[model samples]
Target: MTNEASLGRVLEELGTTLLDVVCGDAKRSGDVGGVVIYDPLDEPELPANALVLGVGLHDPADLARVVTQLGAYGAAALVVRAPVAPDEELAAAARESGVAVLAFARGASWTHLAGMLRSLTADSGPDDAHTLGRIRSGDLFAVANSIAALLDAPVTIEDRNSRLVAFSSRQEATDPSRVQTILGRQVPEQYTRILEERGVFQAIYRSERPVFVAPLPVSDDAAQPPLPRTAIAVRAGDEILGTIWVIVPEPMSEERSQALYEAAQLVAMHMVWQRADADMERQLRAELVSTALQSGPGSLEAVRRLGLRDEPAVVLALTVVESAAEHALPAQLAAERKRLADAFAMHLTAAHPRAAAALIGDVAYGILPLLQEERAVLVATEFLARVGSRLRPLVGVGQLARDSSALARSRSGAERALRVLRSGSVSRQVALLDDVHVDALLIELADLVPRGDIPSGAVARIVAYDRENQTSLIETLRAWLDHFGDVAEASAAMYVHPNTFRYRLRRAAEVGRVDLKDADARLAAMLQLRLMKITDPGF
Candidate 1:
């Protein structure tokens, strides 16, 4: 009639007078879920919850070896026939291995006892069905909290990456690891390392059933029991979404363990729903970004829906330029690009909740909301750091657009900055539109200039003379104008004597058919030469 049975309950049902505890007296409260008869002739595959070893072997050494194997298999407790006196070797092995050791009374029927224990510990049909029903009702937190209350322990739900998603409210009895993990919402790297070293994560990934991990050895005191932990992978079909971690002070009762299993199923369902919702949200955001870039009539409305109304925002473009050696298969490259895009969106949203990001072609674009213009560079710097060195992306920050209507202009600026970076005009990791605006303007202007509109007269004649004679007349003219007609400075710049520089200048005026005495003509010639440098392809 009991919902579940423990080692003590099993022994009591068999009659306390029938068994003697030689060691592991402290672990009498351990739960007994199943019975396994040890056979030395065959390989033993022990279940994690509990194992009641029947007395088929009489040697003390063999009993010690079985106990060691059971402990290594994470068996809660082992039951065996009593010895004439306490076996010191068996006791020592049990203590060292942290496996509970129990002895039945001498001459007790092993077959009768194993049958009785198995029946007593059989799964509670109604209790399990009710627990599963509650789990399937879509209330994972409520079910998890109820389980915690039943077991008198704290519980944490984590994603496959070991990031904490939810945890029980019970914190009256907790460890540093629990506290830190809850505070950070993820397992710290150092604690993750410890778990990795203990093979706990590997076991979780490998096992279909619940995995039991011994408490971490944070303290060296043998008298203090380590914190016992249990994990069940949250799986939907073959895909594991996350895990359910239970911190147990004692072995879990069968009913509670069943509830944990059901909880994992519920967690998996919740994760599937959450991921679907996130995907929808991401798709919508990407559409919004794309629409804004297209400058559609609905773009302003979309921007407002994202919570950026009158607020100023900047467009940041991240161009992925992978090295030839880093090329991957098409499938792998696509997946990597998708991951990077997701990373960009997540980081941008974290920085500014209203920010929107999308991967458009090979570039990831983000419309980042900002309160002030001064923070643009700082935001760009932080973004680059977040991207890290792995991608080696070229980041371009556009000028801040004051309203949603100007978002397209901001995006254009970002694109122009990216183009400038690719053109080798700027050699930095991040290029801001404001920094490259002059070059961008000049480049645009140069493209717009008609071929016939190129400077003629004085500047054209000097260029023609330099090409025909293979002379430095144009160079002399540029140096003289750069020094504001300072003869001494111009001569020093050209590494020539002042008298020689003056002679070259006079020759330049003669070849160009310009009167050097007229200041207006001289200024006009300087302007012509500057425009030719930008607009003329030959220059």
Candidate 2:
């Protein structure tokens, strides 16, 4: 609550240049106050504060006189530090006088204002050398860290399941605990509210709302109320990749919080950059992948890099699964990994040597970033069928994407397609988007049936009963894995008591003597069970 007159006197001495001050009270009073610059009654300079009243003219004539005097004196703009006068009257008077009036809360005396100011003025982007080039996995990780740096706080990024994926921190450079991976674990519900409210991972569950949580108090020898914290949730469109939660031990200044919000947006950009390349591959195919993977001016500034506009394209993704543990040993495993990678690359090269292909790992993949059709099904069937015939590992294809940058989505589609193939019912084949129509087709592969296979009366009756009971033998067989065969994963999926499953499975094994572990046998049994069940619609 310093006076404009005394403040004016100090300004004459300190020579504070380019500072602007406004009267908050005048605006609401309806009486315009006189404005004065540098030496109130003297010269007006570029850095002088011009005092303008927020209210109307006390002397309507003097009001005009003061405004005329002030402008000739030099006022950059009128600012209300805190308006005491009524806004409507003051605004009307200011408008009548053709004077611009702006309002600002006299910033509170924040003890950490210097640090906060530095945060505001500091360069948010990395130095020129550190500017982002092409988006690489490592580069994307770095980008996440850079965003965390801007936040000046430890932030953990979680997926929809609340599994922590990435954490950002510049404060703890070498701390292993800060970067701990929590991807496969469930987050406590209490700690998950921030993300839930932001709809970060909520949509995956088909609903979302903002939620708040108390700052998790740190255990220490001292006792006091801990600082407050906030979190912002994030989702990849409707797909819940998870939430990006910001933890502040104490409430953040409005500026700091706003700065953090901006940083959150930047994190989203990095996610898009990192995942966009892969997404484009599934939808945009080669041209997108080609344009993305092909080297050029890597930074965002390189405008002429690739003028890729949206165009029709088909997307296919291939996964090369290499055993990491097997490849990490001290001995021949490293060499073996290299060999396998080379083989995958060569194999894929032979498949569509001209298609956009890159050796990602044990799996070689293609972006085919550029193509001219949305029909990936027919294209994949013709291309992958031939490749599957020759390749040892499998591949999958997804629907085409109109936007080239979303190619990564194809990887998910391809992964699902491979799962279908791994069911051991079909040989190498393309899984087009339309394959969803093949619920019947997937159950009907001839390869699944034994040559001239026949079911005995008892087995047939049981199969009939299973269908009549509305139980999916296909799912049950998959769940039991050939009556808990030594090679089956029955324990993992069904959480079943193996002995009981074994009894039912033994009965089923007797029906067809189905060797569930054999690829062909599992396929045949699954197909027969599916047919018997589906035909018996009542089941």
- Residue by residue across 34-109, what tens digits does model 2's lDDT show? 2321123323222233333322234334433444444554432353334324345544445555444443233321
TM-score of 2: 0.28
TM-score for each candidate, following the candidate numbering: 0.52, 0.28
Best by TM-score: 1
Q: Which residue pairs clash within candidate 1?
A: none
lDDT scores in order: 0.69, 0.42
Model 2 — which ten-residue stretch has the worst lDDT? 109-118
